[model samples]
Target: MRVTQMLIPTLREVPAEADTISHQLLLRSGMVRKVAAGIYTLLPLGNRVVKKIENIVREEMDRAGGVELQLPIVQPAELWRQSGRWDVYGPEMYRLQDRHGRDFCLGPTHEEIITSLFSQEVNSYRQLPLLLYQIHNKYRDERRPRFGLLRGREFIMKDLYSFDKDEESLEISYRKMYDAYNRIFSRCSLDFRAVEADSGAIGGDVSHEFMVIADTGEDAINFCSECDYAANMEKTPCHIHEKELVEEEGPLELVATPEARTVQDVASDLQVNTEQVLKSLFYNVDGKLVVVLVRGDRLVNETKVINYLGANRLDTADSEEMLNNFGIPMGFAGPVGLREKTAVTILGDLEVKCLFNAVAGANKTGYHYINVNPQRDYQVDHYGDFRVAEEGDPCPCCGAPLQVQRGIEVGHIFKLGTKYSEAMGATILDEHGKEIPVIMGCYGIGVTRTMAAAVEQSNDENGIIWPAAISPFDVLIMAVNQRDELQAEFALNLYQKLKRAGIDVLYDDRQERPGVKFKDADLIGYPVRIVIGKKAISEGLVELKWRATGELIFKEKDKIIAYLQENLTAMKSSKR
Candidate 1:
């Protein structure tokens, strides 16, 4: 490719709307352009990088015994209705009506279509343990699409669905995909971790998300300090509280605590330790009021609260509703008088019931109760794990402290059990000649997001540092002072030689300043740069630079081709 003929509109200034480093660099390098709030058009350079990632995914998926196939992006609403996800997916699904008024949706996933296909064709155990995959466009109506391709409403994705006759067979397919994911990201040179994750709307028995570690990531991940336990912050345990139950404590006393509405305020006003203050929160669980008790320093995990309440949604009781509808003071509601409401239930965290002499709200406007004991003052309907996992909290597996890191999720694999198969009546005969629902597993890689996340994980202040395996081009032939006859001759010779040697080379033949050419070179982040300057003509020495390390090495013009061939091969296959 030559700069004079290509659409390499490298920009000197970053766009105002580009938020993350990847977004800014992508635009500045003339790789992608914004089409809408969450939509983008991949330019020549961007499409090359995307194709490289796609090929890697295809190679790995095929190596794992997956047969590549194309599924429709437009699916019938009846299929989703049969799978019980038509309404459950909510507004995120891009639903529409065709000319005949038949309902359809642009699929964010292909589980329903895949299940329907299986129901029609795969009916016997002989066709069991099948893995099929495809790389295609997926659509989702994101409410707020920011961060470039990271959360785009329309993007490319690779989805692989597995069907097996039973749970045991499903495990074999799941493990194959899991190992393939490890190889795919490893080849991309990503610093990522596979952590336990909630299935969310996908609905599965177990799932794992592969996340690339980055400071600008949106997901919080908890990792064990001494073991292999890693989980998404939404569900990692704050660990089981093991404080012994105090048999006796100071007597209960009501104290004046005017305007102390928050746990910190109460702790400060009462001159007590934060751990010694018992805080109660009012939540509207399935339209019923429930007061949850925890230590002042602890935070509640809403997912745990929702699971405990067995409800689809869990929301904090409206502050005004606590006072008007329930006659409970905003910050002064306590479990001691909480049961009198009859309709409100009291739930306690494991640590709440073990407090010795804790200070608690008094259910009055201007006062709080001090030296209250849960064993004597309040009745807890249940005690369970309900607090957010915190830094330095003990690990659930090995008892070591945990650490939190920000991460961008790029891939997810789920052990889906029979969620979709049973719902859609996708059944196959068992070995014993009995018809049973097929067990399934879903595996996905965000093709576009993975490309952006690679930038997030591997870039410098200058611009994107694409890994060798996924770079737009393997070599950049930079002609310094292209007007100079000697420089142009040397650059053109080297560029032709590289192309003849079957290398993806980009030639900078445009009439531009050396500084402008160098800036664009770094912005594009080609792995190897060959500089043909006056030195190449005068001393027969070509300047060789590695984009990743910025290492400069002088090589004779005659050996430039061989040197690049050796180094480029190693770089593409290198792990780091």
Candidate 2:
């Protein structure tokens, strides 16, 4: 690719709206352009990088015996309805009506469509195990799309589904997909980990998300550094504390906590640790107000609460709703002589249930109850660990200390079981000719997200240091002064040689200043750069620089190709 003929619109200044380093460099390098809030158009350079990532994914998927197929982007709403996801998916799904008034949707995912497809043709156990995949566009109505491609309303994705006859076969397929995902991310030069994750709306029994460590990620991962235990914050278990309960001699007493409302305020005024105080939060669970109690020091895991309540949806109660439902104010509401007449279900944490003399709300302004204990002071219906695991917490698996890290989710494989197939009526006949629901496993990779993540994990201050496996161009041939006929001729000659050697080359033949060209070269982050300058031309040599290490070496013109060949081979070998 020649810079003179290509639209390499390198910018001298970063865009004001660009937040992350990847977004800034991507915009400055002319690789992508933002069209709307989160939508972007990948230019030639960006497209090449994305294609390279996709090719890696495709090869790994193929190696894992995955048969690729293109599923429809716009699927009929009936498929979603059949799978019981039409109402469950909620606002994230982009729904629409055709001219004839038939309901349809731009698929946020394709579990229903794929299950429906398999149900029609795969009727026998003979075709028991099938792994089908597709690389296509996906749409989601993101309420607030930000951070460029990191979180987008529309993006490209590679979604694969596996169908099996039973649980054993499904596990086999799931393992294969999991290994393939590891290879895919490994090939892309991503530092990632497979952590346990909640299935979310994509109903499944077990799931694992491959996350790339990045500071800009939105998801928080709680991982045990000493043991192999990691989980998404939503599903992370709060480790049980072994604190001995202190038995109180007196009964529950209502005290004037005057002007103390928040847990911190009440705890501080009472001269107690946050853990000594009980925090009560109100949430709308299945159209009814529910008061949840937990240790003040712990944060609520809403996902766990929703799963525990067997509710399809849950959200925190707003102040107005809280005022309307509970007569007490927001921060002062707690379980203490509260009317059991209201259909409000009370839920407490394991620690709260074991408390002997815990403080709680008096349900009146500027007042609270002291020396209150559960089972004696108030009755609670349910108790569980509805709090998110925090740092220094013990691991549920092996009792190791837990650590927290932010990671970008690149891929996920889920043992969906009969969640979709059963709902969609995708069944196959067994050996006995009895019909059984097809077990399913879902595998997915964010094609564009992987590209951005590569940039996120690999880049320095200069720009994106793309891994050689997915670089837009393997070698960048930069002519310091294109107007100099000799430099231009030397650059063109070397470019052809590299191309003939089956190497990808991007020839910078533009009449730009050396400084501008150098900045752009680094910003684009090609693995290797060969500079044809005055000194190099005069000395019958070319300056070779490694983008990753910023190491520079002088090579004879005749040896340029050999050096690059050897360096590329070493880089490729290192990746393997």
Which digits, one per residue and each the tens of the lDDT, describe model 1 over residues 1-576? 898989988899989999799999888999999999889999999999999999999999999999999999999999999998898787889999999999999999999999999999998989878998999999999989989999999999999999988778888998898899999999998989999987775777688999999989999999999999999998797656577755657788999988898888999998998998888988888778887889999988877887777666577889887788767897887777766755777888888878868888888888889888876888898988888889999999999999999999999999998889899999998889999999899999999999999988887888889999999999899888899987898899889988998988999998899898889999899988889888888899999999999999999978888888888888777775
- lDDT agreement of model 2 with the native: 0.86
Clashing pairs in 2: none
Question: Which candidate tops lDDT?
Answer: 1
Question: TM per model?
Answer: 0.95, 0.97
The TM-score leader among the candidates is 2
Question: What would the per-residue lDDT of candidate 2 be over residues 32-78, giving only the tens digit for each residue?
Answer: 99999889999999999999989988999899989999999999999
TM-score of 1: 0.95
Residue 420 of model 1 has an lDDT of 90
TM-score of 2: 0.97
